[model samples]
Each structure stands twice: as structure tokens, then as C-alpha cells.
Target: MEIYRAVVARVRPLTASMIRVTLTGGDLPAFTSTGVGDEYVRLFFPHGPDRHDLSLPVPTESGWETPEGRPTAPMRTYTIRAVRPEPGEIDIDFVVHEHGVAAGWAAAAQPGDPIGLNAPTGLYDPPEDVVRQILVADLTGLPAVARILENTPEHIATRVILEVPDKASEQALPAHPRARVTWTHGGNGHSPSRLAELVTTALPGESDLTGTYLWTAGETTALRSVRKHLRRTLGLDSSRFKVVGYWVPGSDTWTERWEALPATVRAELEALWEAPTDDLEDVTIVYEDRLSNLGL
Candidate 1:
């Protein structure tokens, strides 16, 4: 858990509810990421009233150590939307909402703003024998889902199900000739049952799942039920699924919840942080929609 300091280099609105922030600085040379799709980092955002301080517990051999008098910053987990180490930059796509630590920080971020971040870790790698896959996400987990979709082998069949409040919130996803995307507006200004139903109806049957992978994120209850259905009802093996509860609806203690994420997944991330393998050269990310933050 090495702490790295970064200064905001660029901030661009990607959609009605998402903003892409590029962080770069001299201090970022030490930041090395495996560039694995679905990798994330713990962001120690400025907290309290001013949102100006970068104070937080420093990582040590034993664990994080809080200074005697400094106020610990609020922490949030965000997918490493993209990485380009040659230029010493990392992109983080944040869902801009009215509240929450990362949301507020992203809403107000500007160039030269300082931010603290640590641990670029990941748990997703397209299974070697995967015949096909299904990806699902909402605004919060869109970054991770997009990363996976973009990197998936194009020869394999894949489907993506995305839920947003409205058409304006739809961010253009990566293009893969063999992949298809289904966009559904999250009815009633929420993303839950409707998206889950789409997922349920679209999944491959048990006979066809032997060489498949199921990856889903976003609202906890929805995906939790999705996972349960895949495992219990469809008789898919647990090893064939990667389900992450990106956020529980209306959760205020998000940081605390993230810290307690599934132990197996946390272990996977910890192992990656310890010994990240895949080395990728300078990579560039492109988005089709150069849209503004037009609210629904």
C-alpha cells in the first residue's frame, strides 16, 4: 500500500452523470499499474469542510498509521479507468452525484488540485478457456465493466447490459466486433430490478455455461440476486462468476463497506498489489461520446 501523490491534470465530463479526471504529477513516477481491466485504487479524498487537505493515515509495514493530530481523509474505491505510465498519468472515471466523498470531490475537481491515492489492484482476468461472457453495470461500476469489455478477446462472444437514468447518461463503450450492448434506462431514476431482469433473461443456459464467465457490478441487491441465480438456479459453478457489489443503494458508509468487501476478492487484490505481473506498454483510451453533463 504505497501512497502516491498526484495533481489533477485534466477533468472532462463524459456523460450526464460521469466525469473523467486525469491525475498526473512528478510524484506519479512511482505509480506502476498492471493495467489489468477492472483494477482499482483506494482514493484518499479531501474531507471535512474545506475539501482542501490531503491528510490521511500513512501506510507502513504493519498497516496505516494516523498522525496524532491530522484529520484522516475520507477514502473511496474507484476503478482505474485508464493508465498511461509513459506520461505519468492515470484516469479515474467518477460518477458525479450530489453527495458522497468522491462524488463531491469529482464535481469540484480542477487542474492542479492535489489528491492522494494508493494500491492499484485487480481481481479480473478473462478466464483462459472462456467461450463467451456477459457484463453488467450501472454508472458506478461502468468504468470497470468498460475496461473488461474493451480488453476482452474480440473473437469470443460477449454481451454488455448497461443501465443509466436516461439516454444522456449513456457513455459510449469500447467497440468489439463480436460484442453487443443493451442499454436500458433505469426506470424511476433508479437502477435495480429492470437491469437484473435483462441479465437473467440474456444469460446462457447451463449447458452453454461451461465455457462462460459472468461478471456483474453495481447495486448490491440486484447483482447479489443475479449471482445467486447463476449459481443456484442455473447450476453454474462459483468459479465461473465474478460478482461485485459496487454499492448498496443509499449507503452512506461506503468506505467502511468497501473495506469489508468479499475476502476472496480482497485477497486477490492484495496479491496483485504484492506482485502485479502483466506488463503493458503505453496505452491510450478513447471514448466516442464527447458529451457534457446534461442531467436527466
Candidate 2:
């Protein structure tokens, strides 16, 4: 992925925990992002006492330089909330809290703040052969689910189970896809495990699970539980589904653990991640049309 510097054009609160920051600059036009979901991007925040220029370290022939005189900045991974390709604009949503550099920057972000961003190199959509789709996630995974629903066919049988802190955090999804959406509230600062239980119990019957594609992201333990249930009980192939750990409790960096299965299972998963030519064409068309209609 190529790195590009983008400035904050605007920032708005989507909910108590979510903040939407619109980024725009001449550098942004060079980024070619397909769409939103769980596509990975790198965000470089300013460092130093003044919090002005980027704080990245200078590279040396031997390796990276030492701590002294090295500008130390915080780097974070985030999802693309929305993208307007023609206008060279992209929206990133951050979950704000009391700690961490990314959250701190987001809380204080204002118009014209200079930030650095890296372009996305891959798409996160499931394979075209997938007959049914199961989406399991929390607030962090919501944007990805919404993107999939918007891009996929309306007749597809898609089931979504999302866990949020409360009803107020719930978002109205786009209208392109027909989905059976379920919400579970993690009440009063309770651990996300409570919500995971609700997700497991809500899984469809085994017969309905065959040939389905599953994508989940949220708390590490909770996501693991759902992954285990789908593999052990439903007898579904691992390669046909995936569970990504978006954030781990008590940690600032994101760590992802993919469930390792047999060689056959790995092959199946590889195939699913690769997009078909037809699907790629369709995505381009949909994205172009959406852009034109929005007058962006």
C-alpha cells in the first residue's frame, strides 16, 4: 500500500463512541479504494510537544534510527466509513474513549488538521460462489457489514448479528440488500462475552448453514467463540468463513488470529478471498453509479 498525506476536512459525531472524520487533499486522489467494510488502512498521527509535523523515524542503511531526535507518532488501523472517489474524499470512523493516541487525536480533531493515510490494497468481500452469508460483529464491524449489504444482491440470504452498547448506538443500514438483522446489547459496561452468547444461540440450524460464508469481528474472545461454534457444531468448512479480531481488550494495537484448519480448509478459504472477474466488474459499476448519483 502507498502512503499519502491527507488533511481533516471536517469531523462529526455519529454517536457517543463513534466519530466521523472526512479527509480530503490533492494526495487523496491518488488513493484507489474499492469501497468500505474491513479494508485495512494506516493512519499516522502527529507527535512531539507541539503536535505539528509527522513524527515518523528516518530510515538508515543499517536500519531505523535511534529514539533521540526520532519523532515518535502513533499509528492505528481503522475501517473506511465511506468513500467518494471522484471528489477525492474518504470518511473514517473512530471509536473514541479516554485513552490511546488514535482516540485522543480523534476526540480533538478539527478542520484543516494534517494527517497521514495509507491506501488500501485489497477488497474484503466474500467470494461470488458463497450461497449464504452470516455476519457477526459489534460496533467495530458495523461499517464492513453495511458495505457488504450495500454491494451484494438483495435476494441473497444474509443474516447479521451485531452487538452494541445500547439501542442508541444502533445505525440504520443502507437499503440495497435485504437482511435479517439482530441486535444484542452489552448492558452497562459488561464484558462483550455476554453478547457473544446471544450470537451463538442465534445461529441458524445446521442444515441452513451449509455452503455459507461467515465474517465476524469484535472482541477477541467473543469472536473466537462464534468461530468455534460455526466450525464444531455446524460442520461448516473453515475456509468458507472467517473471524477477525478487530480489537483486544486492554490493548492498543490490533491483533488478528485466523483459525487454522486442514489443507483442504485453507484451499477453500483462499478461493473464497479471491474475487471473480464478473464480481469485480459489478463492484466497479455499482461504485461508479453511486458516485454519479451523489454528484460527487
Against the true structure, whose lDDT is highest? 1
Clashing pairs in 2: 37-144
Q: How much is 64 displaced in model 1, in angstroms?
A: 1.8
lDDT of candidate 2 over 1-296, digit per residue (tens)? 45677889899998886888999994898888855466768788897545557764434565333258766567888878778877778888887678878888888888888787766733455666777777877887787777777777776778888888888788888775458888878732345355456556666554565556877777654455565566666765556666676776646332222233445644654555376653333333343343234332
Q: Please list the C-alpha lDDT of all candidates, in the order they appear.
A: 0.74, 0.68
lDDT of 1 by residue, 1-296 (tens): 68888889999999888899999994789998876788988888776666557786788996577688887878888889888887889999988777778888888888888888887888676668898988877777788878888888778888888887789988888899989898878732363446568668878454467678877777765664566567557876556777776765556764565566677755654454355333211010000011011100
TM-score of 1: 0.81
Clashes of 2: 1
CA-RMSD of model 2: 11.5
Candidate 2: where is the Cα deviation over 4 Å?
56-69, 121-123, 187-190, 252-296
